[model samples]
Target chain A: MDVLINLSLNGLATGMLIFLLAAGLTLIFGLMDVLNFAHGGLFAWGAYSGIWIYTATGSFLVGIIGAILTGMLLGILTERWIIKPVYGNHVQQILITLGLMLVLSEMLKVVWGPNQISASTPSYLSGSWEVGGVIIIKYRVFIIAVGLAVFLAVQYVLKKTKIGLVVRAGVMNKEMVQSLGINIQKVFMLVFMIGAGMAALGGMLLGPYSGVIHADMGMEFAILAFIVVVIGGMGSFSGSVMAAILVGLSGSFMAYYVPDLALAANMLLMAVVLIFRPQGLFGAKG
Target chain B: MTRILSNRMNILYLMIAAFLAVLPFVYDSRSLLILLSQVFIFAVLAMSYDILLGYTGIVSFGHAMFFGIGAYTVGVFMKRFEPETSYFLLAVVVTIVLTAVVSYIVGLLTLRLKSHFYAMLTLAFAGLFLVLAEKWRTVTYGNDGFTFRVPEFLRDRTDFYLICLASMVVVFILLKRFTNSPLGKVLQAIRENEQRTESLGYSVLQYKIIASVVSGVLAGIAGILYAVSLRFVNTSVFTMDITLDALLMTIIGGVGTLVGAIIGAGIIEFSHHWLTELAKVHWIFERWIIFFGIIYILVVMFFPMGIVGSLKKLKFSRKKKDSVPVKSETVSQGD
Candidate 1:
């Protein structure tokens, strides 16, 4: 029972990180019909920039903010330049974004030097607490809390705010939204920025959770995020969270029980999901 | 047959083949033979990719899986069995059968999804294969791949180079015929518009599976040549980089043009060879992948239609401006 609880907690934390990345990916895909393969680059940049700032400033909050800002700034540039030209063409988008993915990863090697950087948990969130023989890691709890908070906040905005309404409308029918005189292009840029920022936030938090970050980690995790988006339903935010947790928990448990099958676990899940529900779990029927 | 021989493009192809076939005898340079052999192997791989991406409009991210399957099958057979001609032949047969089955299953499973979904699923499946290769240490020897001896006949560098060239030419001609057939026309129609093709009574899924199977088998053949050339096989055969190389080749040459894939492969392979060579001169050249990535972006942005496609477009426009009565049949045939 103890081991199970610990595994679930670990899975949930990892799921949240994946959710941060997938949320942005799903939103960008939903609203703009643009698949940004380089979103992972923003995630990696966030981790690198955030960790650097955290080390320099000796403040975790400042580091987190710095990472988000860096992600948004890079997001804007990517949106304005790389993604803008290949907007309607899926083939061009895949090729260009993949190129960007490579450039971003290689650039990380260029700037930071080709080496993995070790990260430590912040002083305040370094330890664990044991209650009734169930120990909970502080950092894991912190990650889950942040994930839930972000989910709720984003949910509120989508449900209540004017910009959120426009974004949702754009997802359903961009032409219809444009016919209503909304500047869908600005919304696209805005959504791309927010999505990139969230991915970066996920990367920042992932630094301490894993205790190390590498340039190639972005590609690795980006694949996970893509799996989540597929299983969750491309445009469904809530579905992404559910799918993320499912992937995380399956991965966590598989690692413990069937060690040899650990890596293949999530892939198997995705295949099963795809076979039964091609539109994804929460996706609307085509 | 005589009509095909008389065509201008076919004559150009024959001349190139004749030149390449004789060069190995006239010029006794070992390095050039090796480089040209490598180019031939990759050209086959890229053209196989063209059958799917160019002819059928399917963007697969798991092509390396078939390539890896081929390499590993040959590698394992040669290593475990005797390094004899019979075993090598058996390995080739097994690779074709395995690749066909795997591609069929994969196509059936994932082709039902939308474009991006299909791409992501194929990628996920490829990752699964990579993990399997990594973990199945008993057979694969894990990530530290093993090297094995080849058949006695293949030991000669000149013989192997000729073999690679022959295989490439044969595959190219076969594919050209495949693409110009009535079925190939249907595949092209699907590429232009899937729903419209389905409405015209063609089963889109079946045609996609056929293309996938052909592409997979050809890629497997290329993998066999690649492994035989190096006399080694490893998990790197399954990496995403191999698939990306094929994608870049197909796009940079020309999407639907089989010949363009060959040109793309040559350019990319030469650039790769030269860039790494330049590392000896400049420290900056040590990180050649950055330049590769930049080239990819610039090509997509400026040369979206690729080298062959853009040049063709330029020529067509110039002819139009010249007030020449361009034949509509020729324009449609070119497309």
Candidate 2:
């Protein structure tokens, strides 16, 4: 029972991290119609910057904010200089963004050295809480809270705001949104920055949970996030969240019970999703 | 064929072929052998990538999976059997068979996924191969990678170079023929408009799977040759870096052109030397990443059609300008 509870907590914490990454990726794909292969670069940058801050000051909160800011800055640069020219062309977008992913990953090695950096939870949140023979880690609970909070906050913004309506409309039909006198380009940039910020925050939170951060780490996680995005729906925020959790729980459970098939399992889920619903579970029909 | 190749282009190709044929004689023997072999292998990989991305409009990120299957086929066979088995005959038969079966299964499963979804699934598949290879160290020999001895005939570097050269030329000609054939036309049609082709009664998914399988076989060839050239094979050959390297090579040379794949591979591989040379003169250009990044950006931004594509377009414009006087005379006659 305790083992089950522990796995559940671990799964939820990891799922939240994935959700954070996928949330931004889904939004960017949904709103901009751009497949940013370099999205993982933003995640890595967040991890490096946030960890650097945390290491220098011994404050996790500062590290978190610093990482988010780093993502925002990199996001702005990516959109303006790198992403802007390739906006309508998928091939070009992929080529450039893929290059950027390489550059961003290599840059981490340059800045922080190639070795993986260790990150630990603060002492207050390091231990576990037990009740009725079920034990849960406090930091894992904190991660779950942060994930839920980010999800709910985004949902609230999407549901109750004019910007959200424009975003949804844009996702539905960019031409229609343009016909309505809204600057769709600005909206794209905004969504891209926000998505980058979310990915950054996800990276920061993931740092402690995973116990280390490395540059190439983003590509591996980004692959999973991309899988979640596909399974959920490219532009569907809610779908990304649910799909991320599904992937997280499945991966967590499988790693323990079926270690050999664990990696293949997530891929199999994605393959199945692609076969059955190519537009994705929550994606609107093209 | 005469109409396809003008006299000048023919000479250019003959000249390049001659250079490749004699390259081993001039350069440091081992480096030339390895580099030339690498060029051949990568040329094959790049050409296969063109079949999907340039012609079919399906971008795949898991191309290495097929390449790994090819290497693993050779590795598994070499371990279980003898190296003296009919060298070229056996490797070709086994690689094509093994790659075909594996690609068929993967193609059937993944061919239905659209756009980025399909591409990402392929990436996932590659990662799966990587993890399996890493953890199952006993059979795969794990991360250390396995090496098998080449037959005595292949051990002779000059003879081996000839074999690689012959394989490349044959494959190159076949790819060119395939691209201009009716099937190639159908692939182009699918790329331009899949639904329109579907409405015209074409089986889109079947064609995609077939093309994917064929390309997979070609990549498998490259991987097998690569394993032989290095005197060993490892999962590193199937790394994401190799997949991206092939993509970059294809994009840089000419996505749809067979000649362009070879040219692209040559340029990218040779740049290691070029950049190394440049480093002696300037500190600013010391980093290979910066050079690659800048060139990649330039290519995607300004010459997205690629080096060969741009040159083709230039030739087209020049022809138009040359015929202006004739066009004017014809217009006057009509008037």
Candidate 3:
């Protein structure tokens, strides 16, 4: 029972991490119809920057801001330089973004040695809370709480704000949104920045949760994020959140029960969904 | 004049092949041999990728699935070999058959999906195999993979290269045949106009399945060579990088052109060999990948058609000074 609880917490923590990374991915793809393979690179940078700040200043809150800012900056750069020109052409977008992914990955190594760095939980988060003979790690709870908070905050913004309406309208039809006399470029910039911010936030939390931060983690996690985007329907923020949790819960459970099938299970689910409904769970029809 | 030119092109091909055949003499023999074998294997993989990407206008990111199938099939065969089985022949037939079957099954499941969904799903399949290779460690040897100690009949470079060369040549001829055949025409037809082909009472799914099966078999052959050449088979060969490499080679050499695969493979393998040597510093390989990515982006954006493809276009345009410009016809201008 204790191990189960531990694993469950672990799974939720991981799921939250995935949701953070994937939320931006889902939104970017949903609105832009652009497949940004380089999104992971931003996530990695976020972790690196956040952790670097955390270690230097010994302030977790500052690290989070640092990570989010780093991601937003990178997002602006990529959106302005790489993604802007190749907006419509997928092949070009794929090529440029893939190139960006490589650049970001390489840049990480240049700044930080190629070796993996072990990141620690904040001093306050290092301990555990024991209740009813079960010890729950405080950090995991912190991650879960932060993840839910972000989710709720994003939902609040998306549902209530004028910017959210514009984002939705753009996803429906970029031209139509433009025709409405709103500066679509401004919206793109805003969305791109926000997406980058989310990815960074994901990276910051994932750093301590995994206990090891590496340049390559972004690519691996990006693959999962992409899978979530595909499963949840690209652009459907809610869809990505739900799918990320599903993937997270299932992966955790499977790892415990049938370790051999754990990795394949998510992929199997994707295959089944893709084969049966190419639009994804909540994907809009083409 | 046309016949004479054709003869010259043929001779040029023969000379290039002869030069490649003897390249090991000048370079480090062991490294050159390994590179040569890799070039051939990737050439086959690239060719198979071209069948889906260049010819069919479908960019499949998960082609490594078939390549992995080929590798895993041979590994399975050797692992559970019968006492009397001929390791060489048995491995070849089994890998091809099994890979073809797997491709056929995959085709049935995925052929209906549009480009993006199918592409993502195929990528998922590639990841699936990698996960399986590591997860199902018992049969697959998981991350460690398995080793196939060659039977006494074939051990040296000369013998192995001969098998590789013969297989490649045969597959080449087979692909040539496929491109000229009625089925190939139908596949191209589907690529050009799916509705038109459907209206003509043809089944796009059937054609795609057959092509995938054929491509899978060829990839399987290459996989066997890959294993036998390295004297190793691991899950790493099934990773996204391998798929990316194959895709890179296919795109670089010029998609859809029959001979482009070999050129792409040879150049890339040579580049990799040299780069690996140069990338002694830890961050060098990552930089090299970034450089390649830059080149990839440029090539895809400006020269959308690949090296050989653009050259072919140049030649065709030159042949007829005005020949009704072909670019406007093929390159879609707008949605």
Tell how far residue A193 is off in model 1, in angstroms.
Answer: 0.7
Docking class of 1: medium
lDDT at position B230, candidate 3: 70
Residue A52, model 2, lDDT:
92
Off by over 4 Å in 2: A284-286, B1-6, B26-28, B87-91, B273-287, B325-335
List pairs with backbone clashes in candidate 3: A30-A235
Pairs that clash in candidate 1? none
The candidate that achieves the highest TM-score relative to the unseen native structure: 1
List of chain B TM-scores, one per candidate: 0.95, 0.88, 0.88
Q: Order the candidate numbers by TM-score, best to worst.
A: 1, 2, 3
Off by over 4 Å in 3: A1-4, A284-286, B1-8, B19-30, B79-85, B189-202, B280-287, B319-335
Candidate 3 lDDT, B208-244, residue by residue in tens: 7777777777777777778777767899877877777
Structural similarity to truth (TM-score) of each candidate = 0.96, 0.92, 0.90
Candidate 2 C-alpha lDDT tens digits along B69-176: 777767766765688757555877888987788778777876765566567777887888888877788778888888887666778777778778877888887877
Q: What TM-score does candidate 2 reach? A: 0.92
Higher-ranked by lDDT: 1 or 3: 1
Instruction: Indicate the fraction of true inter-chain contacts that candidate 2 also forms.
Output: 0.49
The candidate that achieves the highest DockQ relative to the unseen native structure? 1
* Candidate 1, A1-286: lDDT as tens digits: 8999999999999999999999999999999887778988999999999998999999999999999999999999999989898778787787789889889988988888889999889989999999899998999999999999999999998989999999888889999999999999999999999999999999999999999999988978888999999889888888899999988888889888997897688887778878998878877743
